[model samples]
Target: MENWEAGWDDGEVGESSFDYSNHTKSQFLDDVERRLKLFMVRCVKVCRTLPGSYDGQHFGQQLIRSSSSAAANFRAVRRGRSQKEYFAKLSVTIEELDESLFWLETLVSTDLMPEHRLADLIDEGYQLLKILSKSRKTASD
Candidate 1:
């Protein structure tokens, strides 16, 4: 049997059996979930520090929606039934990540968030964008 098949149990395989770079569904989803969680945490921290005015509330809501929706759509991708479905759902995630990066830039540029303070969150969004972009490109090819 193949090395991976050796680790299979009943029908599912355990995480310890393989490296994340193996591109197994569970590991990939787990990594993306962790990334989204970190992004959401940073967003909340910055949002809490924003001025409690109309602009803050509006932009804060947008950021929250985009970040959270990307996380949610990844869940759909995890359950995707076909290559077409996976590509479609993953595209949504990439779009949301794109929006999240835009909001991050806007927050810093508009002085709603300090660039120094928000650097990690903004950087994480950009990094995720590149990773997901590659995933989409590979899926299409």
Candidate 2:
């Protein structure tokens, strides 16, 4: 038997999976935007799996909005007309991402979903949040 127990999931994305050092600034921005889109897609997939209960519906709706809004605001950030606008859009993106993370944790805390199932998604959200937070700080300095 092929040791399924020891195998890693192909779909898994970890923090070290990406090496951004080799990418140019433009490419790095593109990759971040793409990652945000993928994050929204993943959030949608998880939301679809939620049971048709009040808590599930409530939190899932919140998650979908925050995740998608994060991605959209990030797109706006890329096209920002000025430094102030870019910073403002970036701030919104970070807020939405933070909200998404809150919803994900809520799902687990409310017993609507297990921690293992949302672990990867939650981790990715944190990574993105940290990146944006740092970017915002650097911009303000």
Candidate 3:
């Protein structure tokens, strides 16, 4: 038996077990979820420091939606029943990730967020985009 299969419950083994490397997928998704949560936390911190004004509200909402959507769409992609569905869901994930990055850039450029503080989260967002793009391409083929 494979090293991975050795730890599994005998009764739980099935075709799906062989079809997907759950360990790998779970690890990747966990990383994605972690980054998304971190992004949201940073957004909240920046938003709190901003003046009570319309710009703050608008920017906060955009950041909240995009950051949250990344994880939501990633979950949807994992649950997809077909390759087509998976790619479609991943496309949304990519879009949301990009949108989050855009908002982060805007925040920095507009001086709402410090560039030094936003650097790490922005890097994470770019990495996620690269990962999602690769996944989407693979699913499409």
Candidate 1: Cα lDDT at 23 = 62
- Candidate 1 CA-lDDT value: 0.71
- Which of candidates 1 and 3 reaches a greater lDDT? 1
Q: Candidate 2, which segments miss by more than 4 Å at Cα?
A: 1-17
| Model 1 misplaced stretches (Cα beyond 4 Å) | 1-25
Q: Considering TM-score, where higher is better, how would the candidates rank from best to worst?
A: 2, 1, 3
lDDT of 3 at 103: 85
Worst 10 residues of 2 by lDDT: 1-10
lDDT against the true structure, each candidate = 0.71, 0.82, 0.67
Report the C-alpha lDDT of model 3 over 55-119, residue by residue, as the tens digit: 76788788878878877887787688876787788788889889988988988887877899888
lDDT of 1 by residue, 12-66 (tens): 2222222344566565667767777778777767777788889888898898889
Clashing pairs in 3: none
Select the stronger candidate by TM-score from 2 and 3: 2
By lDDT rank, best first, the candidates go 2, 1, 3
Q: All candidates' TM-scores?
A: 0.80, 0.87, 0.75
RMSD of each: 7.7, 9.6, 9.4
